[model samples]
Target: MTINDIKNLLNATVVSGHQLLDTEVHNACGSDMMSDVLAFVKDQSVLLTGLVNSQVVRTAEMMDMVCIIFVRGKEPSEEIINLAADRGIVLMKTSLRMFPACGILYQAGLRG
Candidate 1:
């Protein structure tokens, strides 16, 4: 699904890279641990996490992820947003917790 679709699905607020909402994402990885994200994730385009830090953006960049969704209403700082914007990665946040957010996307056909 498109990033726009995921946003709608999760009722997320776009924090950065709004212009790239049309970007398509085939799979998703949900975790707050950047180490697990780096070690276990593969071929995933979207990341759902509660961790609000620049390292999250860096992990997404290294994993070639196109989008990061901050779950549980966590918000990234302006610096983190700027970093993601610079890297051309979409950033969004939702009030939903990680499990429900991941479930919604998975039920909508986005795989892990």
Candidate 2:
């Protein structure tokens, strides 16, 4: 599904990479642990996380994740947002918590 679809599905706000809302994502992985994310790579994926820090952006970069969804209304700082933006990564904030957000996307056909 497209990043736009994800944003709509979770009623999220685009914090950065607004121009990339149409980017396609095949799967999603929700995690607060960067270690787990490092252990696996999902192609054309989005990282759904509650960790609103620059490390999240760095992990997404290392994993080649196209988008980072900050769960449970967590919003990253300006530095974190700029880092993602500089890397051409899409960033958004969703009110849904990690589990529910991941479930919604999964049920909508985005494999985890």
Query: How much lDDT does each candidate structure score?
Result: 0.96, 0.90
Q: Which RMSD values do the candidates have, in order?
A: 0.5, 0.9
List model 2 lDDT by residue over 1-112, tens digit each: 8999999999999999999998888888998998889986656479998988899999999888989999999979999988999999999998899999989999999997
- Candidate 2, run of 10 with poorest lDDT: 36-45
Off by over 4 Å in 1: none
Candidate 2 at 72: error in angstroms? 0.9
Candidates in order, TM-scores: namely: 0.99, 0.96
For model 2, state the Cα shift of residue 58 in Å: 0.6
What TM-score would you give candidate 1 relative to the actual structure?
0.99
